[model samples]
Target: AGLSEAGLDLPPMTAEQRRASLELWQRRKAAVLYSVANNLATVAKDHAAAARVYGQLLTLDPGNSERICAALGRLSMQVGDLQSARHHLGRCAQSAPAERRDFYAAQLAVTSADWATAQRLFRSALDSNPGNMLAANNLAVICLYTGQLREAIRLLESLLERQPKLAIHEGLVFNLCTMYDLESSKSVGKKTRLLETVARHRGDNFDVAAFKF
Candidate 1:
């Protein structure tokens, strides 16, 4: 990967300047390549290799340890290693900066269906980044589960207005609009539009297979 970044010759500069630029570029490329390799290795079911790359990333940049640790925790959760996920996420939650820790902790609790913890963490995340749409959306999710339909609709609608690109948000919106409206399941046209929006934004992180239109 370093060799590849070095291959991209920029327009002529002083020999020393060119050499320094290339050296720095190669280091950046190597970091990116290592991260991508880690992602692919995890996808290929090569957990050991992926773990090594993640560990390397930790050494390469201590400032980014929080996110890398979150990634490791998520992967651990996926592989049925809940104990490991909790262990690492707990460390990250304890020591990470508030901006990152709040969201990461929120995600950990949400994925486990711990609505109470998720609510608390999402509120914390929102306090740090008041305009964080995902955190607001997640808080709405907690409201939905807790049978606060009117409030959930308010939050979900607000999230959609701000960030319309996430398909998963569209799915959540579809559920909320159709189920939680004052009219409940009676607003046929809005329901149709929601389903259509879901299809339009379909691909990645959302499986519309069960949505029969």
Candidate 2:
């Protein structure tokens, strides 16, 4: 599709480049435009435009519609657009692979504050694939919200221990520390231990502020 030649495969670093990519996308409607859309959302931080491009991709690349829908769903969530998140994530779950359907469905449940349904879906996703850190993290959140504090703590801690790479996950660390704060008055010691553990695993790349100590 001449994508590399047009620089559409690379991140557009400036507004002029982004405009050029958008113009090309409007004219081409190629599935390769996903790279441009991803860079627009991730690098340029223009989520609305990225969502628009992904919407177009749903038609241009029906074979990857579920993936595009998932991207749009996450973008909607990041922008606090719960209505759109529910719509897109539900679409994703409808056609996504069996192994991935529950995660998208769980994300859809989150948009409506259906914690019980979300908990069930996320737990199912994690059970099916223990490497699904997002599913595990969300399930832990539902548990915490449902007043199962110890269960939440155990889930996150055990997952982190099993997958040390999760030490760099900001949301997981923050939520775990929040649980520690709620579970006991002696939370600083726990947070300190968490910080040490993460530091040991990730060196200096992990943000210290995520622990909220």
Candidate 3:
């Protein structure tokens, strides 16, 4: 009684055809879910709900779509789900454009306190885009945290030399002043001059006025 057996101009679907049909259906369903998740995330501001929906979509599509994986990764991070963020972001990083993958991977590494990996990825990102001020700033911060003061100073100095007008340059200058203050070899006059420069750029908001040498 089936339509194929009844010869009603309908041919039996092959196994491959059936598999393709099911995959298409799943992809359509995943698309709908992705839309709903985005709406929940952006319009409703329900990150938890959006993450849940995205998790479901991942179950359907897995890593077949890089955008979906990247969205899930970002949403997971927003919800403090570092483990899930690492998983999804790792997959996304594998397929992301070369210019951006290292940046995304570096952020994930930071969440895990993997400073070495983060440094490497951030450096890679900067190497690919030398004008990436954010990457330079982040790498400099990591260098400072790890007590690589000379490297940190070099990074900030290079950035300033290239783009002195960048608003974030003030922060770099402040960090440089702090490093100079900590180094006994740096003369008091030099430190004072650095602090004055920072003060000029940062105005009254510069807190180094109370910092004792």
Candidate 4:
């Protein structure tokens, strides 16, 4: 009964037991309920119930409203409810740093298919954190799709130089190698260089197929 009230599926419980569990849960401290909400989201994958818990937390634990809003925004995004995501993420972004603020806005713009705004906001996100490989990858993808092949290649190449050990970011590496194929007849050499770089960091586990050689 307690688990069900905490957003889990289990065998049926008597109405009296269910009522008792609800009373017990209502008596739980905010911190305990917060932990339960986290477990519901992470372990049980009960996002809807977790979101409700977060909404309750917003009023119960007002001091940590920003953090709760951020978590709720992320969960809304995960469930593909962009309207809810925009509301919560916008609230979180108001107090966030440039990287987080613009990244959230960029995600919203991308969802709306506003590539120009997304590109600008993602560039701001990357500029605020030079080592942000995800922002770099996002910017490069926008450039690639907009017919700016050289700019796309340059962004990824700059990321490689800035954070060489990040070869594990397969998407960035794959996008860079893809641009190499598009921009040069001698892509094999470019791919070889990328492979060599990956080999240094990944040792034997690096997949040769990622280079598209």
CA error at residue 69 for candidate 3, angstroms: 11
Give lDDT tens digits, candidate 4, residues 124-180: 999899998878888999999999999999998888888899877676778888899
Where's the lowest-lDDT run of ten residues in candidate 4? Answer: 1-10
Model 4 lDDT at residue 125: 92
> lDDT for every model?
0.69, 0.85, 0.76, 0.84
Better of 3 and 4 by TM-score: 4
| TM-score of every candidate relative to the true structure | 0.58, 0.74, 0.48, 0.61
Candidate ranking (lDDT, best to worst): 2, 4, 3, 1
**Residue range 25-62, candidate 2, lDDT tens digits:** 65466645888898999789999999988878877777
Cα lDDT of model 1 by residue, 34-102, tens digit: 767566664577765676677777777667777678777767776777777887788788988768688
Residue 64 lDDT in model 2?
Answer: 76
RMSD (CA, angstroms), candidate 1: 5.9
Steric clashes per prediction? 0, 0, 0, 0
The TM-score that candidate 3 achieves is 0.48
The 10-residue segment of model 3 with minimum total lDDT is 1-10
Backbone clash pairs for candidate 3 read: none
- In candidate 3, position 39 carries an lDDT of 98
**Tens digits of per-residue lDDT for model 3 on 49-151?**
8988877876788665677777877788778989988988888788788898998889789779899999999999999988888788889888988989889
